[model samples]
Target: MQQVKAVVARAKGQPVEVTTINVPDPGPGEAVVKIQACGVCHTDLHYREGGINADFPFLLGHEASGVVEAVGDDVTSVAPGDFVVLNWRAVCGQCRACERGEPQYCFATHNATQKMTLAEGDDAGTELSPALGIGAFAEKTLVAAGQCTKVDPSARPAAVGLLGCGVMAGIGAAINTGAVGRGRSVAVIGCGGVGVAAIAGSALAGASPIIAVDIDAGKLETAKALGATHTVDSSTTDPVEAIKEICAQTYAGAEGADVVIEAVGRPETWKQAFYARDLAGTVVLVGVPTPDMTVPELPLIDVFGRGGALKSSWYGDCLPSRDFPMLVDLYQQGRLDLDAFVTEEIGIDDVEAAFAKMHDGGVLRSVVIL
Candidate 1:
């Protein structure tokens, strides 16, 4: 075991602490990663707030990139010195989903069998519940070997680390779940990190008339720079009508965009997405809704009449092993502006400050450099 400095949320709605934790050496099928960079994601904040569960003293942070420091005897997919992105979905190849060659939907994803524990304080020796099974806001962390996806070493850790979560979720929402492609008209509701990533993905896929919907004008401007062909200030304009009007102008008689991504995870925005898609078009919900929030009521006849799919995206339905390397290459080629997603780089101790800045419209991501 080794002691390392890490950020921990000891209780619900309490300030996070930077303290020492004990990370066990890799066991069978596990690996130890020396974290280089980790992005501060909203989910980490959710975990800290007890919004995810009652798992207190949670080791927070998940979106991360690192170098393999050690591996168990059975580990082979990655090795010491390899640059990698950490992922929560470490697929079990024996699962039914993997058996059918759809490991992205693997039913038995896993984490390290061993636990990291609090090394000091009144809570000493208490095992921590890692956020999304990847407690990466630390100098080092232990995870299942499969959680480490090797990528190009030259890629910037601060930029590519985001692929471990939000950026990948957004891109995958469009490219994987929504099946957006060339000539498809796409509209994304919400201009947060994930929403803008959807716009970037749609642009990467050659989607036309990419409409960005947001209440914040600054976020909308960022969306346009990322690939949104048009912008809708939902605070001032009706997004559904604006998206439909834009798509109709490009594709004659079109009622709305071919694909509408609901990234806000709110009832109102989801309703807008539901009604803002063309006939038989898709509605992909990538945003996470709280447990108390129920699906908005709509007519059963509308569901039957829509003739399109309403899907919830789980981690963008991404297979990290396949997608991570490809995305890194794209970033290296300058085709994907992964760097733009990183708003600032901060020390591990500044996590709470970074969390405070999350509501700032100008900040897309605050990355922690270990």
Candidate 2:
């Protein structure tokens, strides 16, 4: 066992307590990683708020970058001293989804088998539940070897780690899920981390007239810097009308954008994405919504009349083994500006404060440098 300091959410709606925990060595297919940096994302906040689930004393923090410290008896994917990104989707090849050749929908994803405990003296040991089975808020985390996606060693943890979640979600929404391609006019509504990443993905795929929509002016500016060729301030103007004007076609083009991505997970924004795109254009919803929330009702004819696909992207429909390293290479080549996603590098203790800043509408991402 190894004594490690980790950020522990002892209960829902409480400040995470930084305390020492006992992390046992990897067993079977698991591997122990010495975390160097982890990205603070909205999902982590959701986990802490119990919006995601009722898993208590959650060992919070995922979207992390680290080095393999040790391997279990059956481990083969990674070895000690290898730099890797920790991904939640550790696809099981035997699953029906994998057998059907869609590992992205893998029915069985692996996690740590051995428990990491919060030891209170000798007899009072409390087992900690790793957030998304990753809990990278600690100096060390135990995960399945399949969770470790090896990447270029030189990639910055603060930047590359973002690929583990939001960035991957947005990019994959366009590339993998939406199947966006050359010359397509895509509009992303939200202009946050995921939206901007969608813009980047559209640009990467040689898309044109990539429109960015958001209420925040600053985020729109950032979106343009990433790849958006046009900006629509949803608060200032009706995005549907603006997109119709932006991606004007010879036809009514009343439908406006070709591919509309709802990065803002609200009933209103989903409506915008539903209507903003051209007929038969794809709409991908990457934003996460709360339990109390529900998609607004729309006309049934509109659904059939739209003639396009409406899809939800979980982790960008990403298969970590394929996307992580590929994205790292693009970032290294300066094709993807990952560093722009990281607004600041903070300590794990600052996560609670970071959550408060999330609504501040300033920072894109606050990474925790362990």
Candidate 3:
């Protein structure tokens, strides 16, 4: 094991301390990544707050872009020195989902066999829990070689890393699950990192008159910049009514949107998505909610009456090996405005503060440049 500086969250709701941790070299099917940048995400905060699980001394940070430093035996996909975006799903190909030809929903994903550790107290601690199977808050981390999706090195790590998670989720919701097409009237709620990306994706797919809904005006402006054609401030006015008004202008005779996306996971917003779609239109839920959260109680008849699909998108239905490099090239060609996602560059030590800022939705993404 090699000693390296890493951000370690020792306890729940406590600040993460930068401490020395032991990182092991890659074993078979694994690779060591020298992280250049990692974006702070809400799930990391949830992990630290003991909301996701009871795994203590959690090694936080997941969304990251890095360079492969070394590869283990039998690895062929990537080599050392390759710039990449790290993914959680290193599809095993033997899983039921993979056998069914849906590798995007790969049932068996992999992580590093070796665990990183720290000397926290009197003992030399081992088996630190890596968030989303990638502890990117460190200078270096170990992950399954398949997780290392090689991308263009020209694109900024801080910016491209955001695409590994939130951005990809939003884009996939629009392009993949929702099937938003040319001249479609799409509306997205939340206007956060994911929502803006959906708007951008809809634009890229040639969807017309994309409507953005949010509680914050600043976020609405960001949505517009990301390609939203219309904006609705849900804080002052009812979002359901606002969306209907916007959709009326483009989607004539339809009661609601042609494609309504709910990027907010709360029951209230979800209900809005349920009621705010055109007949036979799609509703994609890209936002994640707690286990305690439940959908609104409704009659079984209403479900059948909806006449459309209610789908949840995981990682934007993105197959890391298939999507990452293509998107990286898009960013390099200046077709994808990934640079706009990077609001600020921070140190690993500032992760706790970044978590606090996440609540106000103050930043698109705060990237930790290691």
Candidate 4:
């Protein structure tokens, strides 16, 4: 066993605490990773706010890159000394999804069987639920061997680690889920890290007239820097109408985009995405919604009349094995601006402050550099 400092959310709606936690040696099918850096993601904040579940004393933080310290006896995909990006969805090749040749939708994902517990404190002996099966905001973490996706060690940990979640979600939404193509018009609603990455993806896919919609001008400016051809401040303009005007094709009077991505998880934004796409255009919902939230009532006939795919992109439908290394290569080639996502690097203790900055929309990501 190893004692490491980790961030823990002890109760619903309580502040996360940095404390000692016990990390066990890699058992069969497991691995121990010495975390290099972990990006602070909104999911961690959601876990702390009790939005995800009632699993209290949650071990928060998932988006991470690290060096493999140890591996199980049977592990062959990765070994000690490999630099990897940790992924939550570790595909089990025997699952139905894998048998169907869609490992991206793998039903049986792998996670470490052994639990990490509080080492010594008031909560000692308490088994903690690692956030998204990662619990990476620590000096070291235990995970399934498959969760480790080996990448170029030359890449900056703080920048590339964002691919462990948000960045990958955004890029995959456009490339894998939406299948954005050359000359297609794309609009991404919400200008946060995920949304901006979608803009970058659209750009990489050769999209034109890429429109970014957000309430914050600062975020819109960031989106432009990332690759948005146009931006709409939703606070001052009707986003649906703006997108319609921007993507209008005079031939058929199709006043909407070829693809519209809703990155804000709300009924209002979803409705905008629904109405902002061209005839037979796709709408990809990559944003996470609260359990209490529901889709607003819309005409059922309209759904059929729209005649296009309406899909929810879970983790952007990404297969980590195929995506992680490719994106790292793109980043190294200076094609994908992954570094733009890192607003600052901080110590583990500054997570609470990072959460505050995230709440206020002050930073794209505050990385915890251990």
Candidate 5:
């Protein structure tokens, strides 16, 4: 075991602390990673607020990139000195989803079998529940060997680390789940990190008339920089109408976009996405909702009349092994502006301040460089 400085959320609604924790050496099928960069995401904030569960003293931060330091006797996929992006979905290939050649939808994902523990103060020896099983806001962390996906070493760690979560979800929502393609019309509702990423992915895929909808004008501007052809301020205007008008202009006689992505995870916005797609279009929901939230009521006849698919995206339905390296290469080639998502670089001790800045419209991501 080794002690390292890490960020820990000891109780709900309390400030996070930078303290020491014990990371055990890799066991069978596990590996130890020396974290280089980790992004501050809303999900970490959710874990701090007890929104994920009652698992207090949670080790936060998941979107991370690192170098392999050590591996168990059975490990081979990655090795010491390899640069990697850590992922939560370490697939078990024997699962039914994998058997069907869809490991992206693998029902059984896993993390390290051994636990990291609090190494000091009153909470000494307490086992920590890692956020998404990746507790990466630290100098080092142990995880399942499969969680580490090898990527180009030359890629910037701060930029590519985001692929472990939100960015991947947004891009996947477009390219994979929505099947956005050349000349397709697309509308994205949100303009947050994930929403803007969807816009970028659509642009990369040659989608036309990419409409960005958000309440904040600043976020909409960021969306445009990332690839949105048009912007909609939904707080003052009707997004559905705007999307329809925009798509109709691009594709003759089209009622709306070919694909509508709901990235806000709100009922009203989701409703807008539901109605903002053309006939036989696709609606992909990549935003996460709270437990108390229920599905919005809509006419069953409307669902029948839509003649399209309504799908929820889980981690953008991505397979890290296949997608991470490809994306890193794209980033290296300057085709993907992965760096734009990083608003600022901060120290591990500044996580609380970063969390406070999460609501700022100008800030897309605050990355912690360890």
Candidate 6:
């Protein structure tokens, strides 16, 4: 067993604590990773607030980049010393989703079979539920071998690690799910990390007249740097009307954009996305919603009248094997400004503080560097 420092949420609605935990040796299909850096994602906060589930003391951290330190004898996909990013979707090839050739929607993902427990405390023997199958806010973590996606070692850990979750979801929303292309008019609502990343993805795909909508001017400014052609302060302006007016310039007579991405998980914003797109346009919802939240009732005829796709993007429908390395290379070449996502580099002890900053919108991403 290996003793490591990890962040844990001991109870619902409580702050996370950094404590010592026990990590077991790799078993069949498992590996141990020495975490280099991990991004503080909103999902981690959700897990702590009991928004995910009631499993506590939960180990909270997922968007991470690390180096493989050991591997089980049966693991052939990755070995020790490989630089990698941890992904929650470790596809089980036998699942129906994989059998049908869409591993991206794999119904069964892999996780460590053995549990990691508290090292020394009243809860010393308690098994901790790792958030999103990866408790990465630690010095080292144990995970399924397939969870490790090998990438170029030269890539900066703090920036590349964001690709493991939120960034990937945003980028995927525009590229994979929305299928944004050259000269396509696109609008992204709610310009947080995910929203800004969506703008970046749209730019990378060569989308023109990219409109970014958000209440915060700071985030909108960041979006512009990332490649947004215009910004809308949604708090004062009607985003739907703004999007339609801006996109109309591209279409000459059209009323809306070819694609509208909703990165904020709220029923109201969803309604905006639904009405903000041009006829036969796509609407991709990448933001997560709470169970209590329900879609506001809309006419069935309107749904049929839309005549386009309305889809939810799960982790951007990304296949890590195809995306991680390529995005990293883009970042390395200075084409993609992944580094701009990192607003600050914090230590493990400051995760709670980072969480506060995220809640207040004071930073884009506060990475925990080990």
Runs off by more than 4 Å, candidate 5 = none
Residue pairs of candidate 4 with colliding backbone atoms = none
lDDT of 6 by residue, 276-346 (tens): 99998899999899999999788999899978899999999998888989999999999999999999999
Across 43-106, the per-residue lDDT of candidate 3 in tens digits comes to 7888889888888888888999999999998899999999999999899999899999999999
Candidate 6 C-alpha RMSD relative to the actual structure = 0.8
lDDT of 2 by residue, 1-370 (tens): 9998898887788877788888899999999999998988888888888888886878888989999999998888999999999999999999999999999999899998898988664433688889889999999999999999999999998899988888898999989988888878899999888889999999999888889999999999999899888899888899998888888852354457778999989989999888988988888999998878887899999999979889999889999999999999999999888999999999978888888899898999999998
lDDT of 2 at 105: 93
**Lowest lDDT 10-mer window, candidate 4?**
246-255
Clashes of each: 0, 0, 0, 0, 0, 0
lDDT ranking from best candidate downward: 1, 5, 6, 4, 2, 3
Q: For all the candidates, what are their Cα RMSDs to the real structure?
A: 0.7, 1.6, 1.2, 1.0, 0.7, 0.8
Cα TM-score of candidate 2: 0.97
Report the Cα lDDT for residue 252, model 6.
89
Of 5 and 6, the candidate ranking higher by lDDT:
5
Model 1: per-residue Cα lDDT at residue 298: 95
> How accurate locally, in lDDT, is each candidate?
0.95, 0.89, 0.88, 0.93, 0.95, 0.93
Model 1, C-alpha of 93: deviation from truth (Å): 1.0
What TM value does model 4 have? Answer: 0.98
TM-score of each: 0.99, 0.97, 0.97, 0.98, 0.99, 0.99
TM-score of 1: 0.99
Cα misplacement distance, residue 74 of candidate 1 (Å): 0.8
Worst 10 residues of 6 by lDDT: 247-256
